[model samples]
Target: MRRSELVLLASFTLGLLTTRDAFAWCRTTTTQGFVPTSEKPCDDTGIPLYWSTRCVGFSVQRDASRWIDLATTRSVAQKSFDAWKNSSCPADPVSCTGSFDQGHPSIEVKDLGPVSCDCVEYNGKVGNANTIVFRDLAWTECDGTPKSDADTTLALTTVTFNTETGEIYDADMEVNTANNPITTDDPPGRVLYDFQSILTHEAGHFLGLAHTNLPQPTDKTKTPTMYARYEQREVYMRDLSNDDVCAICAAYPPNRSAPCDTTPRRGLALECGGGDPETTTKSGCGCMVLGQKPSGLDAVIVGATCLLGLGVVARRRRR
Candidate 1:
């Protein structure tokens, strides 16, 4: 198949976006309700485009040790941190580096004495420096700072890119169930939120992905990596879809496109509109469309026909 054709077929198999609403969230774990109807791009100034080069890291700290076990909480945070590193670091090691790895540009988790601030603040330290500190404030004890609606839940707040300081700060808090478990849309009941799931989403923000507005009219409906919702049963805080990987790759295509054989492989079935390949047209060629298995014979037939057409063209040219 032609390169473009191969890409399209791959996209169809992987299920590319068809409509804007496809990216919208049905619900959010935060009290802010669903993400606001805003058309903000992931990074207005384009800093995220180079974020991978800057080195992504985090520090988990606790203000007080009351609500949950510090060891358990740190373990959970580490799990989430590792998830981000594995998926995002393959392309840019500097930006996706974590404390576990022996790197300078990394995230650090520190214990601050108590759960004073809203869950934690990932503010860009040293004037936009890429750093995140996870502060677990045992409960509703504000760190002398007044709590606003924005700070109520363990929400990711303030993604600032400072050109002067060359730093980026992103912060958020962890929900403390010491007093009463917060109610959320997730299945756990009582403790409405899932720590890992919420952190995974926030980490995406830290990586510079914006909230997906309802996809454009021509896009498909699928769960996006940046979707503004939390899955109840999800435990790993770091999980990314092909689209997410594609976005990061596009932002930082290696100095040169890696040879096709060198490209990392993925294992998953690529479905388009819940239909077989015969009914779908290939979209684009990139890492986003690789390794998607077709679900039916129709898809195989479509692929075969395309390959045959290419063969015919090659023969005619040879003659």
Candidate 2:
């Protein structure tokens, strides 16, 4: 299958305007840009993408990144997830200028250690792993197909969900280590891509968030973690902005009743295939066959573009 068919590309052409401050968070919808028409319109428009379960398991590729060690990769991944997992609603509206709602998100992220498979895939017939992989050699689909914008993309998260209800079934994060120099150094002397900052932003995408649009002339310090573009050496995206907290709280409210299942939808497969070899399914909401694209479900691919001296806006792409 072609790379375009595999994942959606988040273009670095910011055209849509996203809200900012307390109520500026936007969720990934089955139908992109679907807003309900009402006088008292709700932010929860269309079928917003989300996980039904409270506990989600994320696994790191065994090989990790060529730029960073396996241990460091695991550590950064954990910290990135923690940034969102431990987020709480704003206590004081005055102190927190972007306070959106009350209560913490009822979600837990667990590290399932390293897995042999670095493929970005979701299997419906057998077990699956919500993997975090680094593309040290090339950026491609699970079948090793090169992405169209691999040279410009810093990271991308592919989320498979039920188009009818917008329930996310599986999500896999892929970092572009081949074209970008990913670093974990704190306050680096030179310009290098911060791993934690990038992953934390992608984690938000993993949790069902799209690139937040803010009006021009807004506070630059308060840019949401879900903001589309990267700022090269900046680490602000590593921590959750007040707007980021609002996004989490809005999606997974506190005390929400959900079972903690760390395992992927069907089960857990260290590798990719667990079903037929020749058959492939692209029909929204179906299982995938080896050497074939996913079926029976619609997948959304959100990406963060690298700031390689180009001033472009990035937006989520749907498939």
Candidate 3:
């Protein structure tokens, strides 16, 4: 049965690919329960998260600071994690409907290479480090200076889980040079800000998924990269919708594929100086939970005179 594998099994029974579904998340508070006490994470009713971890490492930050360039930010963050692991299902990633390829995704994203420190630290720790950085010149929001709010967030993803066992451990993503203008180059109108369509909506919050809404009414001009914000030379939030494939098949469904060890239980090291607080509390860790977006606010606002220079979340549109 190989007429090109029966035309790839009739393109998966004629769904004709290019698909996605409704999905939403970004919340906290766990001990083995849903999270969403709502203060932010772009809170619209946050309470659907995943990543019980098997391996995660997205490192990048090798002195290409304040001007952005270090092999085009690690080649568009590995094409935004291969647009969710090549949209799964080579042999049935749970019948792969996509949206981070539904469940038993066995969480894997290791390339954990470069490092000169791009902190997302969780100091109450023993393990951490999952990053992606770019903030040339300057840009800080989440009440840490540099337009400390009032809309202008182009990109920012931060997740630090386990208020009781949602277990994320760490997460970080920031992109937004000073004020605007960010690129991965696909030109046409060139208003910039399409670095792999906001690194695939910050890799859908680096895999805990959230910010979805744009399925029932048809009035969002354009939504779902997890749905929060996108517009301005708008590069179509780089795919995934059907409510983000029904929110990763209702949080990691995909018929439980196993045998994993993606290798990054939590990593970080190129030098931040460690000397054993148990090997710096269990190798390369960091997380603070201050995210920004195209300005979709699910988390931010912490100022008692906090101002860094690089620590971002910008791109505010959807009002």
Candidate 4:
């Protein structure tokens, strides 16, 4: 399916925009049922897929010699990449091992040369340039003239990822350094956005996940982590929730239907109380049958709520 269509399907299934959190519902769709072993995309269907394949490598550059501190820029970029790698492959044996068994790809960043609008063309597209060069130029440099403008204007002043090539390219132009010491004063650090956060989000896109939007047009509620716009410093792209993990696994399940052993694997219902709904419901009903009182009240409430909601849902389904 097209990327846009996938995003729409995800929004519809989750009933919310919180993409990562709501993706848990995606596995419930009948269409997502087991692909015939022969039709599995990866060669080794026995293993779950890994994130390594998404981010193959990165290229970093800045304008002019003094435009930015190469050391600091490189450090932040490396840290961001490492954070994403570690998150994808935690030290834990269970999580790490399972992901590794899948053919996840790895990524590395290189210092490409400086960029100049004089020799290059900016079509407002990224990944078009295999090498990202930083030019000590400003927007005015590319305004009309050529040679004189090259030294003043910056080109491609944003960090963008090419989904086709799995490459991250950043150009330092007209970046607001303000309080950012790494790129303020002196030559000025021209990073367009927070390096760590933007990379994190772009990495998500590289991993075969698409932007998530709010399910209800009027809801005005933000979807989960995979939401298109970046709003909070805390919601880094590197962080993966239970829903994220499940989506990856569902898209690439292990051989022989090993079933994820971690907490609340796919196919399990999410309880309102934050535990397994199936277990909670079964136990709650058992308690009621056994003449339990106050303790069972919570379960009773859950059951009633579920029934009422289910009735409404069922009616809607019928219609």
What TM-score would every model get versus the actual structure?
A: 0.44, 0.74, 0.30, 0.34
| Ranking according to TM-score, highest score first | 2, 1, 4, 3
In model 4, what lDDT does residue 56 have? 35
Which ten contiguous residues of candidate 2 have the minimum total lDDT? 303-312
Off by over 4 Å in 3: 1-93, 96-119, 125-166, 176-180, 183-190, 194-200, 203-205, 208-234, 242-247, 250-319
lDDT of 2 by residue, 1-319 (tens): 5776544333222212222243355666665333323332224555777889999988888888767888898888889988888887754422234444566688877898888887766665667788888888886666677765665688888776665677887788888888777788897455367788888898888888766654432565567777777777777778787767877777787768999888787777787754323233331212111223335333333211111111124432435
Q: Which lDDT tens digits does candidate 1 get at residues 205-256?
A: 5544455544422332234555554433343224554344444433334343
For candidate 3, write residues 1-319 as lDDT tens digits. 6799999888876654323211133322222222223332334333435576445677776765455577777777777666665444323222334334333344557667777655544322234456676666566532254533323566676565543335565566767666676666675755456777777877766677655533322554345566556665666667654455444544554565544554433335454432112212111112222321121122322110011112223445658
Each prediction's total of clashing residue pairs, residues at least 3 apart in sequence or on different chains, is 59, 11, 43, 22
Root mean square deviation (Cα) for candidate 2: 12.5
Q: Which candidate leads the pack in TM-score? A: 2
- Position 149, candidate 4: lDDT: 25
Model 2 bad stretches (over 4 Å): 1-23, 32-45, 90-102, 188-191, 216-219, 274-319
lDDT of 4 by residue, 124-207 (tens): 212222222333433222233322222211122222222223222221223222212113211133323334444444444333
lDDT, residue 58, candidate 3: 71
